[model samples]
Target chain A: MIGAGVLWWLSAPDDITRPYAADVTPDIQAGALVFAAGGCASCHAAPEAKGDAKLHLAGGLAFDSDFGTFYAPNISSDAAAGIGTWTLEDFARAVTKGVSPQGRHYYPAFPYTAYARMTPQDVADLHAYMATLPADATPSKPHDVGFPFNIRRSVGLWKFMFSDTRDVLTDAQTPQIARGRYLVEGLSHCGECHTPRNALGALDRNAWLSGAANPSGKGRIPGITPAQLDWSEADLIEYLTSGFTPDYDSAGGKMADVVANLAQLPEADRAAIAAYLKALP
Target chain B: MTGFTKTILGTGLCAALIASAGFAASHSSVTNKAVAARHAQMQMIGYHTGVLGAIAKGEMEYDSAMVDAAATNLRELAKLDGTTMWVAGTEQGATDGSRAKAEIWSDAAGFAQKFTDLENAASAMIGAADAAAVGAAMGGIGGSCKGCHQDYRGPKS
Candidate 1:
């Protein structure tokens, strides 16, 4: 038991100390683009928030999964209740390494596994941008996970065993394809829903972008592999921009929110994503 | 008279002469009939929406008459009472292939509001002068469809 305890202690991810050793001034405008690409407002904003209300980032939506219901916490600029108190290093470590400012491990429900691959520069930019958003003083909600999964220490072991951020698509030849791969594999985190999860809730990388059972247990999310989708690049560009399928079916459910965010991106970015999907072998 | 005139005259005479005529009730189950009716209603809506969407996307040449007709059809469809087809207990798991969720009945007012949004959007679209105007209206029309589906429609089975 003592040996096991020691191993567990050593497994916790180290806090990122002074992540920006040299002063690198973040571009707030570029960070807004990153914010759009990340879809930060989808889960963090109040549930069903529309228009400018989504910009508040007050964070009260409940995400139901097998383990438990995870609530998105307040990431607004409130110094008392939000990340406004966090330093750049604190934000960077939490985002890229899933380690908290207090050294606790955040549950993977936060999607840090994908955010782990984000560039340090992007993380800095995002942090700067989030600072400009409206502040909400709502206290962060506690997660309702049970028993062994509830223990934050156990998450350390899980992270040690499963946190693999290697490039999933090795053959991204063009720069556009490479950018698509970065967004898909990292900030956009499409695999969080598209890829199946193992017994431990880690994404099954081998079946990347193939849809899985809806986490809420209503119905199956459709597979988007080239074999399954079969939409031309133009069809995808149109769908991403306008939420219309080739057959005139409108996108429904959570995907509608995703399309709303993707629509805000540059047309080139949408085309790049389509090109990447086409290149998937 | 022309064939078109003869067909219109025949339809009018048939409607006048067949007043109060009774027909056999449909043999389909009540649940099946309700679900099927809603499916047909939705298809009609989709078809009209697509007609406008094609013009908005520049895939179809914009004809003022065609655009007006499609937008009018959508407004009329939205105004129709959908209660019979949206009967309670016809939600997703209660019947196969029905994507309607229980919230349709539990939160009936919210669902009705979605229809109102569609009706208003379609009414605004009726006199759109050009493809650009139609394209601008598609945002509201399509957004109303998506907003309701996001909350009240279940995933495909």
Candidate 2:
């Protein structure tokens, strides 16, 4: 029995260990840029409206979903209150597998299911960038959710139902397109906003890019699929560069802030983004 | 016809259709086009003026004279007829590939207020072309741009 237990312990997968290699610093930096593009700070950061901007990623943003009011948790580097003690493997597992450092299940509100397609290098870069932030010692806030949601283990079932743990696949036939795909599907996570959700809040893969209501309770995020946006490559490029649509109109609300960041990026990267978005099926 | 020939013919037809659609889509009200062109020109002027103003104030040092000249041009550009440029359905120009949100249309008054704010700020910059006051001008102009952009621009990613 002792020998069997030892064998089981040795064979049992450690939730934290990830299949990652070093020497991916450049890719990691690029991934950090991609993370910025994805606007992770906008949602994950504590709300500035309530006058506490210093909280950083000590998440307190409330996201009201059909499941319930889901408050974001503190993801800082605090040893006691945050993930300060977490290993790179632990961070990767949380981001890629939706498993907390302590092996607890994380709610889908954390976006790990979509982030699962991210390259390990990108994840590492994001991890590195996150590590540089000032550690806040705020304790993790409990979810206001009731019933089954209150039981954190329920996320295991949620994972089984909706998680797609595949890395972003790139085709050699179109390297630029492939880069765009990786950037969009992985770090950018565009589908999180544009793709509609089902009753279970899982993305409806078949009707991908068809447009959906914003999860933040703002206006509907329009579909940018070729069929819907009908934008030329130049149009997309201009829009990305200047935040103006080809029709000379400006985007509004959160999108405006997003454009501001994109506008500051290198033109070549913007063109690549335009090219990729146009090619989306 | 052979398969290659059929494919070529189909692609050619599709290309023609797309071209026609693009052409039709390109058409806009002549008046609106003029207004949009003027607005775009003003935007460029505002951008340059801000840069120049920064230089003049010693906060930045790129080209003070050139920036001052650009600010003059912007003052002139802002004087053009902008009556219909920011109207509903006219917020975006044919060449402007912006994701102009519906709020611009739904809340036209507030949107127009931003334009007025921009014009006022730009006009003020021209009056105070002195190095000492350039910083203030920069702030005013930037404030207007931010005011409009905050509510209207799309996400960059």
Per residue, candidate 1 scores C-alpha lDDT tens digits across A114-169 of 99888877888899999999998888888889988898888988888788899889
Cα lDDT tens digits for candidate 2, A219-256: 46888788888888877776675554532344556665
Say which docking band candidate 1 falls in.
acceptable
* Candidate 1 steric clashes: 0
lDDT accuracy of residue B96 in candidate 2: 46
The residue pairs found clashing in candidate 1 are none
| iRMSD computed for candidate 2 | 9.5
Query: What lDDT does each candidate get?
Result: 0.83, 0.62
Off by over 4 Å in 1: A1-6, A21-23, B1-31
DockQ of the two-chain complex in candidate 1: 0.28
DockQ of each: 0.28, 0.12
For model 1, the local distance difference test gives: 0.83
- Count the clashes in each prediction: 0, 25
Interface CA RMSD, all predictions: 8.9, 9.5
